[model samples]
Target: MTESPRPSEGRSGGAQPAADLARIVVFAAFTAVLGTFPGIYLAGAAVPIVLQNTGPLLAGSLLGARRGAASVLLLLVLVALGLPLLSGGRGGIAPFFGPSGGFLVGWIASALVVGLIVSAARRPTLAVLLPANLAGIAVDYLFGVPFMAQAIGDLRAAGVASLGYLPGDLAKIVLVSLVAAAVHRAFPNSLPRRKAAAKA
Candidate 1:
C-alpha cells in the first residue's frame, strides 16, 4: 500500500516556514511603501487619487488568497498602531473613522477576493484579468461608498466623488493585468493554480 505524505507534503511540501513569513512581511511592507507615492487631491474632495491600490493589486495577483489578505491586514495593523503608512503618510485610527474608512475596510477583503480569482484562473487573459480587477474594485466601492455617504450625510455626493477613482482605477486595472499575465506565465508556480472542477 502507498503511504500518505506528511503534514507539510504536497501543496506546500517544499515551502519553508520562514519563507512564508517573509513573503507576508515583504508584501505588507511593499504595500505600505507604495502608499507613500504622492496623490492628486481633487479640488473639493476629501480623499486624494493615489496609486496606493497598486500594492494590493500586485499582492493579490502574486501571492494568492490567504497570503494576500494577510499582507494587507498586517499593513493595516501597523497603520492602526499609528504608523504613517498610508498615502501622503496618512495613518492611525483616525483614517479608519473618516469618510474613506469603508474603502480601507474593503482593501483586505478585496485582496482576498481578487487573489482567489486571479490565482484560480487557468490563464491570465483579458477574460480573467478585466473581471478580476473590476470585481475587486467594485468590492472596495461596495464598502467604501456607503461609509462615505454616511459620513457626508449625502449618498449623492459620495457617489459623485467616487467617480474620481474611475480613470485611475481603470489604468491600474490595465497595468496590473499586464504585469500579472507576464509574471504568471514566466513563473507559473509563483501564485496559486486554478483548482480542477470537481467531477460528478
Candidate 2:
C-alpha cells in the first residue's frame, strides 16, 4: 500500500497558504498606516517626500518578490478604490494621475527588484539588503522621473527636482536594511522558500 503523508507534513502544507495570506494583508495595512504620517512637499517640486515609500522596501525584504508585490498591490487597490490610504489623506484614481503617480506605480516594480535580490542572497545581511534596497529605489526613480518630467514638461528640471529626495531615501535605505537584516536573523523561515535557493 502507498504510504500516507505524515501529519506534520500535512499540517505545514495546510498552514502555509493561510500564513502567506495573513502576511500579505498585514503588510498592506502596514503600508497604509505609514501614509498616516503627513508628506512634506519640497519648495518647488510637486512630488512630496513621504514615509510610505519605505513600505515597498520593507515588504520586499521580508516577503520576497511575489508576496512583496502583492502587498503593495493590495494597498494600491485600496487607494484606487477611493480609500484615503495614501499620504496627506489622498486616494482614489486622482493620485494615480498626479505628479506622484509614477512613483506610486513604481512601488510594485521596486518591491519585485528588492525581493528578487534579497531572495538570491544566502543570508539577508545588511550588506546584501542595503544594495538590494538601493536598487529598488533606483527602479522607483526610473519610473518616477520620466513621468514627472512628462507631467511638468521638463526632463532636466524633473531630474534635478528628484534630487531633493536623496537624503530621505538614503535614510530609508539604512533603516530598512537594518530592520530586514535583524528580522531575517531572528526568523530565518520568514524568507520565502522557493526563491531562497541559490543557483549554482
lDDT of 2 by residue, 8-127 (tens): 422321235667677778998999999998777767667777888999999999988767888898899989999999878989999989876899999999998999898778778999
For each predicted model, how many residue pairs clash, with residues at least 3 apart or on different chains? Answer: 0, 0
- For model 1, residues 88-183, the per-residue Cα lDDT tens digits are 888889999998899998988888888888767766666787788777888889989999999999999999888888777888888887887787
So what's the TM-score on candidate 2? 0.84
The segments of candidate 1 whose C-alpha lies over 4 angstroms from its true place after superposition are 1-15, 40-48, 193-200
- Report lDDT (Cα) of residue 189, candidate 1: 67
Tell me the TM-score of each prediction against the true structure.
Answer: 0.82, 0.84
Model 2: per-residue Cα lDDT at residue 181: 91
Model 1 pairs in collision? none
Q: What lDDT does the true structure give each of the candidates? A: 0.77, 0.84
Give the TM-score comparing model 1 with the true structure, all chains together.
0.82
